[model samples]
Target: MTIKKKSRVTSLAAGRPPTARKPKSISRKATKALINTHHVLEKKKAQAIAKGDRAAEIAIESEIDALGGIEKYQLASLQGQRLDRGGDSSHILMEWLNSMDSTISSSAGAHLKMLEVGALSTKNACSASGFFDVERIDLNSQSDGILQQDFMKRPLPKDDSERFDIISLSLVLNFVPDAMGRGAMLLRTLDFLKQPDTQYSSGLRTFFPSLFMVLPAPCVTNSRYMNESHLETIMNALGYVKAQSKITHKLVYHLWVRKSGVQCPPATFKKTELRPGHSRNNFAVVLSGSSG
Candidate 1:
């Protein structure tokens, strides 16, 4: 019996599993390769999104969310810099205009008058934009022709003082939070714009005078007011032709021109309340970190 028991114990000892080996750690090179693969996938996905691929967009966005959406992905990218979407439209506008025309020349450039709403400085206004005169205005800022009242709270520019050939609405539209308010704000802005003065040239091919406007990207996509199609339709109805458009992650810049003879489409937001304070108030309360 003892011999039999000894044999059983020996068999059990022999059957016992060899010491388990430790799992291998990922090598630094392998880890880098994995990360590179991920970035490659994301780049492909981003390219597809640029081409308006919805599926790719969703996939990438999901990954962005998994990796902490707001932190991992920037809203806009330009020349290796990240920009706050809707922070400024002037740079985008400058790039777009530069693509078509050279910077402002002193003699003829004087004929081009520009208006910059929420304008902080004239730095990129006239010279960079190829404009003759640039009027910088902010809320309640009545010094040196800078209207000092809120765009919605204040009265319209007294007489022809508020008119301009080009109006930069950079980052302004996004201020208004409500959908209808945004639409109303847009309509009201139109009132300040004048048809480009074609009186200079009589030829049919002469530069058709038009209003040039630069606004935020969300003006088309975000809000309850409408979608891109509706915005285009509305602008078209107003007799404004979309002459040019540029979209960056941070901002959207577009040129709108009203032909001399075209009648504006019947105004939809004519009676819509210009919630002048709504946008400002919302930002003031929500984005308190924003400086004066």
Candidate 2:
């Protein structure tokens, strides 16, 4: 699909240099409405693509365009993350990292390299803290430092030297329109995370590869096909041991450490109802060809 030259409005919202143009002021309620509606339309578009329903896909595309397109959706998301607004989630990630190892913040030698997926701002807490060497990327970048690239399409590192010490997937998994895609995304992380060299000792375990993930609360708490336990099962099967987690009324945060040479469990997580509430959402993650 061809993306037109960025519209004037999009250019203002896009990740241009600070002098380009400031985004227009938009109320939080309006911003949220745009984001939520865009998410609904995106899911519809994904389903249409899955079924090869070109007509439905085009119609959904029209709706998304009317709703100001993916560019606007990304802008609203960035606004919502402003310090005066909900505050950047990366603050939580920074907190968890320090809590895990205070030395991580002070040790210059431990300048951990990080890949921040779906990044909206280059000045978020992690970037500002100077604790991590952050490489930010988004499908639609909104700042000068963040790369306009799809994480799913990024090339795998050729070796451990090129792999990152940490990978941040904040609000990224939920944005994936399908469960299988989410699973594949999770599995793909293993390929980019730096595996420890035999010469390295356990003393520097704080620098080991890890995944810092954040998602909206309902994706786990109120979904019929997913919950905390189910998510744990999937991550465990993928050899990620939960190191830290925090659940707020609106979001869930987790830090997962990769376990070298761990065996994947033969469990299959299908879209069966684990919770019996009619109000539950349809969020789920499915590993391909895995069986109980």
Candidate 3:
């Protein structure tokens, strides 16, 4: 019996489980390959976004560059000499002028006389008007020739029938303190163009055939009276229709037309607003003599 019991114990000990072995080390090359693949994908994504942003930025910068840079206000004075001897052609101005009706001639009349309101000291006004016989009316002056409150308040010009074929109002409207005042100013300006002794009299009544206005882009403002939409709305109310619109650089430009006898078409805002960084404001309207 003792011998049988000892043999049973030895069999039980032999049936015990074996110990577990340690895992093998990961290969350095395999680990590095996994990390590199992940990094490359992340880098590609970053580059794509950066490229997109850069393209947008370049588009805006190009417009501004075309406007002769931020020192554009100085353009007139710098090019003043050229103005007296006839100025160079501007791509922006030519493009704007050409976009008008096809019947209109690109050349100004032999003795074209122009009155530029809010004339920045730049050749832009001259270049846009095809270098017409231009007279820079300095609003900054206080003398008789300078624009006065009386002129703004008075009846339209009595003389000068069909005096000017084209009139440009660039960067002038915003200087007005409020919308109502600006509207009033616009009306008064039209009055200057009104035909003498006619019910349909407005500035350009017998003076100009077309008018162009350039303004800043719309943005948040502290002054409710000076918003962009208000200005545009006022213009529409006065029978002006947008003939052309463009955004170059960050600037916004619009051209409107008022024919002598015919009513203007309904106003429609152009969908092409200036982007944050365009380089120029290339906008224009042409009214052929035959359109009337």
Candidate 4:
């Protein structure tokens, strides 16, 4: 018999402190569900491999996809979300940040006017966790030094004339449950960038800003993670280009820039094969030739 699935919003509770344990318990439940499904699939995958049943293996892999991204969605939907996405993601992000230090320092004329969406009510918003100056904004969390508003709702920063120097979305796209929702967020993210009209040849623009998007592994199919390699393709369709990219087992990361005089109609992708070397945990950073 088919069983009922819990709604994503069911994992959340209202009017609770960020330190509340009941909500954490709810997240553990979601994590448990994902772990059980993962173990079962691992066994089935091994069995299929032994029998040389490739089709069976593929089918079981499809079943595993159903549980994919749920752990992250639950975390994003839970209380006291962190800059690290509640696991080892912080280590990978730190390395990525260190790699950027020289680049950021050399861009002499560039300045940072940054904003971080879904920045939880934690003591350190994602950027500040690493001591960066990004301002945090969260609709559901209490504002520390950051703003509190919904990105898709009546957010104060949603104006067409308004823009920032940097916008960061960390492990946020996967939490969206549907393609349209994810697309909507992507478009909205673009809206906050300075328009390309004033873009600089070797520096930043007058009003437009760069973007950094971090996606979790085991991502839900057809979600924003599709932009990993096809970022230029997707962003070009949106009048933007990929400024940079870093893909690993833990995440799909990108930096984007808007194109001058380009206005694009919406583009849609129905399916995509995820990058290989499946992540062992939601936040593990697997070395290129090494498994986590």
Candidate 5:
């Protein structure tokens, strides 16, 4: 969804205290319903366009409107992310960062800059850690700190000063409706990451520039066209090497370091099925042209 900037109007002074304004608890079932319905409608719309079925495309649009549009989908997603709901993925990221050497804290001359895409709240673990200087953005801003902007529309960095040490795509890649767009999004991260250099020489802490990504477990585990090995192949092709990963029953988290001079895989990736099953999903990441 393309989000336009809107004035943030609030009655905080007269309303209840800020802590009392928490997102109301949403049932897991209801949240899943909203998110699933939105994905289905978006997929149908994409298929209609592919087949040149204008009538079907219009029908899908109406269905989406009836579902309360992208705003409703975003709200459901945000609710699902509330800390009480096992929504914040940054806790895993923080764990990985703490395990790394030469840790950079606020005391360091510079904090590691992070571009957090699809950020839902300004209070996630990463924001509170005091280790990262985060730039939060989302397609639809739910709070004051997150900028209402699409990651694809973000301007390209001019040089090192404009780049970041890490880019977090927590549950954001799966939000793109199409596979090709997902691949493009991954590649785009490389452009925003700092180029390899001697550790601490530039006042930055040790460690390579990295991409921290989180996705629904099914996107890899139960997809017809993608699996763990396939995903690793794709990332390796893009000059990334997995540094850490943790897979749960519902979610998968990965941290891929941007390697300095590795060559991309010899072949391109497409939606060819790697696993055949009627229940498998269509999740895929298809790269066009060269990777990295």
Candidate 6:
């Protein structure tokens, strides 16, 4: 006789399903902690927006403070002191002022020609009206008629035989994708500004002897390739020397002089230092043609 073993019955077999594990409940303290963390993150984001919104105001206030408040201005006026006097940039301003004093000429009659690369609103605004016969050349195809025309297609006028006293390439180098490309573009700019005689002349010569390059300051571009040293190196390689340098709010203005007769000293590195009896922070560099 064959005997069949009885099957063991589970809770499911008995019409009661096995008890499922329940999720652990969060404590009130943990819930509050999570809420607090979320709030902190939101607060930080708000603070960042506030900071960004007030950045310009902060910068202006800082500048005024550096200038020694209202008393400094009073003293400056009393002493007949020009605020920007002895700043290496006086030469450029003097040249511009001298030009302005002369008879006003048509945009065509102006002796000095200017080629502004990467034409932006700031460059356009700072540009002297009737100051050096100005011609704007932008690379963006969309900027047609806004400037004279795009530089890539309509090359600078070959017939007009005037050389620019100053050629400005402002705040545009960092946008170049690579160093080789940037170098090529820089060379091209130099080539365009260069006088035709230099192209055929025997001696080592340049097209436009004066170049004002306003590069992105330490604060402007995030790219490693774009910096003060890099720009100086490029200019030096192209046979230009730093004639003047000033650290303004948004940019590093460098007035470069092509192998001119005047040999200026190299730029000196000066750490801003606070001293006793000094009205404000002072930079220690001795201004000369060459960098110290």
Best by TM-score: 2
Clashes of 2: 2
Tens digits of lDDT, candidate 4, 204-289 = 34223556677754442233234334545555666667666666654666666666433423445443434444442221111111
lDDT of 6 by residue, 1-292 (tens): 9999986766553653432322234444553344334333333434444578566545555555565443333233222212233222223433443443433333234355666665533223335444555666654322343364544455544643644556776645543433343455555554455432333222222223567765435422333223456556546655577766777653566667665232234332222222333233111212222321
Instruction: State TM-scores per candidate.
Output: 0.50, 0.87, 0.44, 0.53, 0.86, 0.42
RMSD of each: 21.2, 6.7, 30.1, 13.5, 7.1, 24.0
Candidate 2 per-residue lDDT, tens place, 1-292, comes to 9988854644543665654567787789998798778878888999999999999999999999998787788888888888798698989877766665555644546667899999988888989887778899999876779999988899988877678888999999999998888988888887888774423336446436789999989999999899898898888887778888999988999988876533444555667789988898889999874422
Summing lDDT over every window of 10 consecutive residues in candidate 3, give the lowest-scoring window: 283-292
lDDT ranking, high to low: 5, 2, 4, 1, 6, 3
What do the candidate models score in CA lDDT, each in turn? 0.48, 0.81, 0.44, 0.54, 0.83, 0.45
Please estimate how well model 2 matches the true structure, expressed as its whole-model Cα lDDT: 0.81
Query: Model 5 segments beyond 4 Å from truth?
Result: 1-23, 198-207, 261-267
Query: Higher-lDDT candidate among 5 and 6?
Result: 5
- lDDT by residue for model 1 (47-123), tens: 67669999887887677567534222212111112132223346655554554353233235336566667554445
Could you arrange the candidates by TM-score from highest to lowest? 2, 5, 4, 1, 3, 6
Per-residue lDDT of 244 in model 3: 64
Best by lDDT: 5
Which regions of candidate 2 fall more than 4 Å away from where they truly are? Answer: 1-20, 100-102, 105-108, 196-207, 262-267, 289-292
TM-score of 5: 0.86
Candidate 5 collision pairs: none
* lDDT, residue 85, candidate 4: 44
Predicted structure 4, TM vs. truth: 0.53
Expressed as tens digits, the lDDT of each residue in 194-264 for candidate 3 is 33233322322332344566554542122222345544554555656666666554346666655433235
Q: What does the lDDT read for residue 19 in candidate 4?
A: 52
Better of 3 and 6 by lDDT: 6
